[model samples]
Target: MPTTPRPVKTVLASVTAAVLLAAAAATPAHAQSPPLRDLADQQGLRMGAAVASHLLDDADYRRTAATEFNSVTHENDLKWESVQPQPGQYSWSGADRLVEFAEQNGQQIHGHTLVWHSQLPSWVENGSFTPAELTQVMEDHIDTTMGRYRGQIQTWDVVNEPIGDDAQFRNSVFHRVLGEDFIAQSLHMARAADPEATLFINDYNIDGINAKSDAYYELAQDLLAQGAPLDGIGLQGHLISGQLPQDIQQNIQRFADLGLEVMITELDIRMTMPVTQQKLEQQARDYTQVMDACLAVSGCSGVTVWGVTDAHSWVPDHFTGEGAALPIDDDYEAKPAYWSIHEALGGDGQNGPDDPGPGEPGTGTCEVAYDFTSQWGQGAVVEVTVHNGSGSAVQDWSLTWERPSGEQISSAWNSLIQQSGTTVTAGPVEWNRSIAPGGQVSFGFQTTHAGAPSVPGGFSLGSESCTIR
Candidate 1:
């Protein structure tokens, strides 16, 4: 079902400037918004999305992908059918364009699917060959593909969807001709081609402790015992709204126990069509749940949403009466899911586009407003906005507050934060150091507390007492 890739348009400087101007006019707040990639980086995790090569021509699509994600995956361009459609013939233009885009944007490339049962070229699927010849063909494919991008691709799905719902190996061409040995062989060949790349076996429906996951767990143990080169397990979290697996953290921890990294790959929470406000809200909570599950597990490295926006989501074509599976709308507006994910990644957690932020207009020289953006059993995200109500601009402002006993500040963003004993001081970073007379700057921090979170008071700006709201 892969579409033919269109010629990628190289964005000229003039067009790029125009696009930026148009985008700013359309959504001015986005310019000051902290990107998801920055928030995820603060936590030592990556936020990624799958990219359709054809969509790179769209300015909005390209801009969102470049700004929001730290890693990129080609949706179909790197598949066997897309890359090699004929015997001894390889097409690299579409794939190369995506790689170039990722490199230019400083994003890591997750080379998808060196081997899979689906999306195979007709020559590979319909060819008549003996087991030895077929094995040679597979090895050659891996060598050529992996060798071409050895150091550029940080990780790869060496084999994909190898196990079935019935907890047995699928009768794929590789499995049918060479039995289960083909998986180990593919891993070995991939390692030989790119020794530094992290190799993974990816699949769907293994996000929890189900029979399919059990099968993979056993298979991984056996492969490692036999000295196969395996480094990670990819759980494709293509889930329905409100149906996230309850034991997601446990499952990730179990895989981590195997001494292999775990990643939530191909994540999308789809719902029935004619999307409603309630459905969208539920989807937001579901997205936050998935982020929380990943953040809770030490071995879970990152997550990759399947596509950039609902306009480009594949759910409608595949699932009848189901759509709206992404964080951005068709018009390039941020959905509730986007804010949920932002807060989950330790952002300031402004409610939505219309949110006026923390406080009303004040007559005092400086005013501070504090709000608890998100709270769980033991953790909370707090946002403090510093309003510059003075007639003149405020330069290089610093704020001080006392931390409540038994509360611990884990991480913060948009400022330089430090604590000694019960007192905490925060100063603006270079980009946010100056605030106009009527402008305000907000900073957030994540904290762990016992019982309910205690609010810190007695705020001061430089040597002046500030009005609190």
Candidate 2:
């Protein structure tokens, strides 16, 4: 769901298995190269592809998918709308087709999603069911679909894109009726249906540690604390040219520290169309960077690209002027990005999982500088610059400091603020969640008190105490 511009309109067509293997004979560029799956297996990774049922029919596409990938995620066939279009009624023909292909090809089936805000059926969206009724509807869908595919699939994106960039829960129909608990409830239901399937909360813009990711981090912690059935975090590595977030490894590490698995679930780097060789090379580097980050973190389950070829890439329609996102182009030619990833996975029979792999940036301290932007009478606007004094990157941050006596935060911007006595905690909003090495983001708030502006004392970012100014 790499920031979809519009909804996917149709379920892909079905393809025969014979066509799948035949594509290998066509031998697109890099046909001489070793399969990506073999290289990934050496490193204990599940190299994956997001597949539409129809793509399996194209000889080259099918050959590449079945040969190069060890895992397959249904691009759209497994979603709620595609599976259950009406109340209590279900359809699995499309999803079954993909599952059968994965099994036939000896690939692990990674279920795309069980619940998502978009791609939901009309009944679920327009049926103004009460909160209790909607809860049943959601649980029923989970039981029906997940029950059908129980042990067949390895993972399920139980909840997807639940948190928006604003660092707040998205206003999906589920949220409208069931509130935040909807998330935990969905996970619980999914777990009940498929006890063996790994359950994940997946999102885009979370490939790096940032505000939106921070929100998920917080939610994941809460869910775990409550003993809710959450398993992994899916980093939808939907990247753009020259804009890879710098803290990918750190982000993955922190999530791993939480004892949850992580996966680069849907990765693609889109650039402006009519592409150049330089851009493709850059894209290759970006793809390698992502795979490298996955390798650095122990709990990272694997990496899965969004699609097999650019011809069917969603970029052209979703992102105007942007295409050529996949490693393979429309004509089944492997781009530089393909070889870059191949090299990262140890290239044609080179290194194994024991290798230290590539290096990653180090972490350091975070510091904050505060100032009163404007003051008049009892009201003053205060801004604090949270600097990533750390040599590495700082992901979704929490800034806490002690306010002067009787001072109260009236309102805030660029952060989520909470006050308990003189201690104030301001976490990032969506925009300012991450700070690259030496980079900084500032959040401001209006305060009311009897005296002129006064500085807060003893700021801290997460557990790291900051030098306050």
* lDDT of candidates 1 onward, in order: 0.80, 0.77
TM-score of each: 0.75, 0.71
Q: How big is the RMSD of model 2?
A: 24.1
Best by lDDT: 1
Candidate 2's residue-wise lDDT over 148-225, tens digit each? Answer: 888889898999998888999999999988999999999999989988989999999988878888898899999999
lDDT of 1 by residue, 104-187 (tens): 566888988888988899889877879999988998898998888888889999999989899999988988899999999999
lDDT for position 426 in model 2? 80
What is the RMSD, in Å, between candidate 1 and the native fold over all Cα?
11.6
Clashing pairs in 2: 23-59, 211-433
